[model samples]
Target: MATINSSIVIISLPAIFKGIGLNPLEPGNVSYLLWILMGYMLVTAVFVVTFGRLGDIYGRVKIYNIGFIVFTAGSIALALDPYSAGAGAMWLIVWRVVQGVGGAMLFANSTAILTDAFPVNKRGFALGINQVAAIAGSFIGLIVGGLLAVVDWRAVFFVSVPIGIIGTIWSYKSLHEVGTSTKSSVDWPGNITFAVGLTAVLAGITYGIQPYGGMTMGWLNPWVLAAIIGGLALLVVFVMIELRVANPMFNMHLFKIRAFTSGIFAGLLAAIGRGGLQFMLIIWLQGIWLPLHGYSYEDTPLWAGIYLLPITIGFLIAGPLSGALSDRFGARAFATTGLLLNAATFLALLVIPVNFEYWEFALITGLSGIGSGLFSSPNRTAIMNSVPANQRGSASGMAGAALNAGSSLSIGVFFSLMIAGLSSSLPGAMTAGLSQNGVPANIAAQIGQTPPVGSLFAAFLGYNPIESLLGPTGVLGSLSAQNSATLTGQTFFPELLSGPFHDGLVLVFVVAAAMSVIAAVMSITRGSRYVHVEEAVPEKGASVPQPSTRSV
Candidate 1:
């Protein structure tokens, strides 16, 4: 449920915007669109560590139970949004953040709970299933959102209510606190610094992808620069505070474990690569490929999700199998090989043309999914196994933070690269295309100079790009009927966009391939599989046993 909710919003944004009467392409409302897309992730990334620490201090089962109820309430509130336009957008964003809080609680503790329940020998297989579900939920959410949004926008949120309720009751009744809990005061200073710093950084990155002044992106905006720099400074201070705190929200000393540290670094890199690839592929399908192939803009979202099924199938097939294999062969070989496969597939993508065959696209993406599934499950198992039982919650939280933060960061970095690539050649191509289609030369030039971000969003949201761009300027009304019809047709904008979009795709895929190679290198260096041993404690009236570290 946690992972599904995280992704469902991506494919549902168009329907939701229409239902709420908001124009996401408008300059003032772009922030609303960005917030809806990114706020849930930012909040979850910021809070998971703190919540995980809370699980360690209190009880994982107790916190996890509360999460389901909170998540259900947030879903109910989202489905019942009463306003329209900006007000409605705000209402949904706030509740999405609330839902994120619930998700953070669950994400922080779920892996730790599994670790406690399964014996060391069976842990890789168990964690692989759990990890696959979490990763696969993202792809599954895309299809679910597409299908449900066609019927009613509210159905997206409404579908989660029943599931949340059932999960809540089942978790409360069945899950026990099997892991040891430590009694410690909350680390206020550390929590505040970490939350504020990470939130500021991610918000800056989120807004940085939008246009500012005459630039295609907001990187030079004073607010964005301040947020990024100031956030980094605060994080440095946070590290110092953690080193001195009596009970830190995140234990810095966990980095001393080679398996834990190496696994996390590799996971973060792999996550960024995977996240960026997902966005780029969606844009490629919805914006250029599907439209060129006769799909209308309004129908692109659903078809795009349907077409991406091979990637999800690969993930489903490889995830559990890799995990079970890693249990005997160790994580290093499987994880490294997976990342290497990802790198090879990314290189393959770079060579494929924008208008390539569907079978070729599916095969490459499916291999990419197989690679990611192979890496994620074993890496998670390795990290969880390397931590002492008492610190498993905290360790799990760190892993979640790495994945979430990497995803958020990927959007900012990859989007900036694509936009930069587009800005150079897209304006000239668009101006020529429009002028040839009977648009006045001056109007065509004017429209061409406008930021590419608007066009990108138009395509992403399944809006008719030419109509949306030219309608407000009254250019469409001035054009002849034949010209206007041609401009607004499914083929026109996509045909114009293909060359420039492919230019951007090349750069994005190359960078992704490099990141994957680096991740593979890191994965190989994680050394042999190691599990930490916990000391035994007396029964009845004895004090809680302190976990000792002995990794082997």
Candidate 2:
């Protein structure tokens, strides 16, 4: 439920904004869209580490139970939001942040709890199942949100209430402190710096995608620059504090474990690529392909989610199998080969046309999903197995932080790349297309000057870019009936957009592929499989052994 909620709102946003009586694409209201989309992720990234450390100090199951209750309460609050317009949006955003807090608590401790419960030989299979749930939930949320949005907007949030209630009650009744909770002082300074610093950098990246100083992106904005630079400086301070502090919030020594460090890096890279693929695919389908194929703007959101099901299907098939296999075969081959497959799929997506056939699109996406699933379980299992028992909570938190942080980073990186690609050609294309359809040259030029991000977002939110772009200008009302119909027709805008959108899609896919390749390199270079031993170190002359053929 926690992970599903992380992505549910994305597919439900059109209904959500409509229910709230707000026009989200309006310049002033754009932040509402961005905040609602990013707030949950941002809070989760910032608080995961701290909450994991808290789990270590207290008890993993205790904190996890509390997480369920808090999440349920937040869902209820969200469902019951009574305001309209800005107030309504704010209400949801604030509650979403609350949900993020609860989510962080659950994510930070779940892995450690599993590690404690399962034996080493079976840990990969156990963690693989856990990892599958974690990864697949994000994609599943899309389908669930679409189906629920068809019923009512509030159902998206309310759907979680009963599930959370059940989970919370069951967890409290059945779970107790199974892992040792070492008593220790919370590293307050380290916590403060790490949270603040990471938040600043991520928030900066988020804001950086927006327009400022008449440019397509805000990378040069003074505040964006300050936030990013200051955040980095503070992170430096955080590392120093962790090294010097006796009871560090994040154990610096964990990096010394080659399996742990390499796994984290590879996981982070895959997440970055995957997140970009999620958003970009949504835009591609909702904005360009679906509309061209005759789906209405309002219906595009749900269908986009529906169309993305192949990837989820592939993940469901591959995640557990690879995870179980990795236990006896080590992570090197599966982890590396899976990511290489992912890179191949990214390039495949690039090779396909913007308005691609369904089967071709599904095949490529399913392969990508399989790659992700294959990598996720073993990658996570390797990370957990390589860490000591006492540091498992912190290690889990750090890994979660990396995954969430990579997701956050992908938004900024890919959006900027796509926007930059569109900037060079989209304006001219729009101006030409609009002018040819009997719109005045001046009006066409003025509309063309609108930032490309607005169009990208319009398509992203399942709005027809042409209609959304033309609505505010009031020019559609003045045009002749045939001309207005032509301007608003699905195919016309999609045809005009195909050239520019592909230009942008190429750049986005290329970068995503490169990230996957680099990630695979990291995966292959993680040395041999090695689980940490707390009490009994390996004999002085002993070499790392091969993977066991033991069954659970």
Candidate 3:
């Protein structure tokens, strides 16, 4: 439920914005759009490690149960939102942060719980199923959100309530911690620096994509630079603090494990590519392909999700099997090969036209999914297995943090790359298309001058790009009905978009492929299959466990 809710709101954004009485694609409102999309992720990314450390100091199961309760409460609050416009958006954002806190708890500790439940050799299969379930939830959430949000926007939030409730009950009733715990005081300085620093960095990146003054992106903005630079400075301080502190929130020494460190880096890169792909595909499907194929704007979200099922099929096929196989064969080969395959898929995507055949699109994306499944579990197993038993909670948290952070970063990195591509080409296309479709040259130029991010957001949120572009200026109303219909028709905007969107796709996919390839390089360098040796704890005194690897 935690992971599923992450993507659910994305597909349902059209209904959500409409229900809240806000135009998210408008220049002034774009920040709201970004925050709504990224806030939960940003919050979760920053705090997962802290919660993981807390789980270590306290108990994993106890923290996880609390997460379910908090998450359900947040869902209820979201469903019951009583305001409209910005106030309503704020309400949702605040509650979403609440949900994020709960999500971090669950994400950080769930792996530790799984590791505790499973033996060493079987850990790969268990983690595989768990990781697959999480990724599947993200994919499935798109379809579920579209269906529920169509009936009522609130239904999207309401849907999580019952599931959260059931999960809460089940976790509390059945889960008991069997894993070792570290009895240490909370590292307050480390916690404060890490949370605040990572939050600043991620939030800065999130806002960095928004327009500032005359620039298409806020990279030039003083505030953005400050946030990013200041965040980095604090992170440096965080590292120093962690090294000196007796009980650090994140164990700095964990980086010594080649498998764990490499897995985290490779996984983080893969996540950036994967998360960016999700958003890009959503825009591609909802903005261009579905409408071009004659689906109504309102129906695009649901259909887009449906079209993405082939990717999930690929995941279902590869995830568990790879996990089981990696247990015997070692993770290095599977993890490296999977990402290399994903890189090939990225290259494949670049060659496909913007208006691609469904089957061709499916085949490429299915291969991408297979690549993801092949890497996810084995990488996770390697990370978990490479850490000492007592640090499992922290290890899990770090892994979760890497995943969420990569996802959060994708919004900035991929979108900025696409925005750069669009900035160069989209203006001419928008101007020419609008002018030809009965809009005045001056007005068309003005609309064309608007940042390309708006167009991307409009399409991503399932709004007809031309309608949103022309509606406010009354250009559509002024034109002859036939001309207006033609401009707003299924075909015009997508056809107008095809060339420029293709340029954007090339930029985005090329970067994504490069990331996958680099991640593959990282995966291959992780040495061999090995699990960390566990030391027996003495009954009375503190046990100093040696951190050493044992080939499994």
Candidate 2 contains a number of clashing pairs equal to: 0
1 or 2, which is superior by TM-score? Answer: 1
For candidate 1, the C-alpha RMSD (Å) to the true structure equals 1.9
lDDT of 3 by residue, 250-345 (tens): 899999889999999999999999999999999999988898898998898789889999888898889998888888888999899899999999
Q: How far is candidate 2 from the true structure (C-alpha RMSD, Å)?
A: 3.5
TM-score of 3: 0.97
Positional deviation of 66 in candidate 2, in angstroms? 0.9
Model 2, stretches more than 4 Å misplaced? 471-474, 536-552
lDDT of 2 by residue, 1-552 (tens): 877887789889999999999999888998999899988988898998888888899989988889998889999999999999999999999999999999999999999999999887888899999988998999999889888887899999999999999999999999877786778999999999999999999999989999998888999999999999999999999999999999999999889878889999999999999999999988888778998888887788788889999999999889999999988988878899889999999899988888788999999999999999889999999998887777888989999998898888888999999999999999999999999998889989998988998988877887766777777778889999999898878778778878998999889999999999999999988877778755544689987554322212
lDDT tens per residue, model 1, 1-552: 888887788888999999999989887998899889888888888998988899999999888899899899999999999999999999999999999999999999999999999988889999999999888998888889878888899999999999999999999889998988999999999999999999999889878988888888999999999999999999999999999998998899999988899999999999889888878888888888998998876677788889888889999989999998888888999999999999999899888888999999999999988998899999999999898887888999999998888878888988888888889888999899999988889989999998988787776676667887788778888889888889998888888888988888788888988998998888888889888888777898988877655545
Tell me how many residue pairs clash in candidate 3: 0
**TM-score between model 2 and native:** 0.96
TM-score of each: 0.97, 0.96, 0.97
lDDT of each: 0.89, 0.89, 0.90
Q: What RMSD does each model have against the real structure?
A: 1.9, 3.5, 1.9
Cα deviation at 37, candidate 1, in Å, is 0.4
**lDDT of the structure predicted as candidate 2:** 0.89
